[model samples]
Target: MFRLAALFLALSPATAFACGQPVCLVDPDSLSLTKIITFEGERAGAGPGHNIDDVLPLQGATFGEHFAGQSVGARGPHDEVSGDAFAPLTMMAGRAGQNLSLVHFSGNTVLNGYGSAGFPKRDAQGEGAIAVLFDQDQSALAFDLRGGEDGAALVHFYRRDGSFIGPVPVQPTGEFAVAFLRSDGHADIAGFVLTNTDPQGLALDSLRFGKPPDMS
Candidate 1:
């Protein structure tokens, strides 16, 4: 029975991801981020899966740090066989059932709601904000996002002083798309702010950054 359970877990991408203790490595005042990618979980299932409480945020794992206060409050790992009805991102069809799955994201990292357990991908609120405080100064940041065609999502950058910088408008493409952002004045990065206007915010994933000048 134990072997069967293990096999079931292995063969299915709907298994919850294991959460551990890995302190923040990126020093907000040190190395800069260059580039980021999409999270397909290696096409593990039929859609994108995120492990709530994943300690590693640098490599795509994200928790509700900004809202949860002290690195807690994840939606629990999600490895269900859900369908990706989003048009722009239908490419993520799961591999097992031959349905589109986001099995292979740019890397294995992703935001499990980044700042809260509430998944904002389907949020219908007119406006909302989510933030993530980094251990390192992020001079620049970028990520892959998808949203409803009518809604608009903006990625905001903040400095160490907790001052808001500029907002990069994420065009509603209704599909998985990449958005790049740099400090308006080449300031060091402290936190990332994602705001949704109109219908709701988009689904954000992966991340790459370094110096503001180096646009990877």
Candidate 2:
């Protein structure tokens, strides 16, 4: 039960990713993100499983902030098991008697449906983006994301073992932010301010456990 704010960012390369911002760049010396993956949870042999789509957005774009004004039908937390892009089908076998199957659709509806959440209230749209970073023999990832307009933002963290660690803190900037964590346990976090003066504004925000660049 880790708690991060609604504006923090996340990085997950174990699965394919898409972003709404152009700031996320791959270091090239790391792995590559190939395809976008979708996951559905299993219930008592009925009911639809939780669905989650990953979105990476370019900087300076305002998305999903409108959803903040109202409750949405497609809002919820997702377990990595039910519909995670990085986990393989074989991992589902660990669960008791329940059988999990992967459904290959032409594309993910949840990830692509952010546009319909209503605007001002604008639909959340994004392009696929992936970047990789490494720490010696181990690997880590970085990404830029944008939830649909009004859609609250969140940052989730997990260890290399596929276990949940927690969420990070997010600034109350009213826009999205990107987070980068190195395998060595250091992070550099920042976000583009959602304003008119410097439409493409950027700030050298804070880190969880290490020194970050001066924001002044």
Q: Highest lDDT, which number?
A: 1
Best by TM-score: 1
How do all models score by TM-score? Answer: 0.45, 0.25
Each candidate's number of clashing pairs is 45, 30
User: Candidate 2, TM-score vs. the true structure?
Assistant: 0.25
Model 2 lDDT per residue over 28-80, tens place: 22322222222223111111112223222222211111111112123221111
Candidate 1 Cα outliers beyond 4 Å, as residue runs: 1-56, 59-130, 176-185, 197-201, 212-216
Candidate 1 per-residue C-alpha lDDT over 1-216 given as tens digits, one digit per residue, 9 for 90 to 100: 775555334322232122111111122223234545445443232133432322234353232323221122222221212111221111111112211112223444333232222322322111223455555665345555544456565555445564544455655534454433332324355665555543433445565554435324
lDDT of 2 at 215: 46
**Each model's Cα RMSD:** 18.6, 17.0
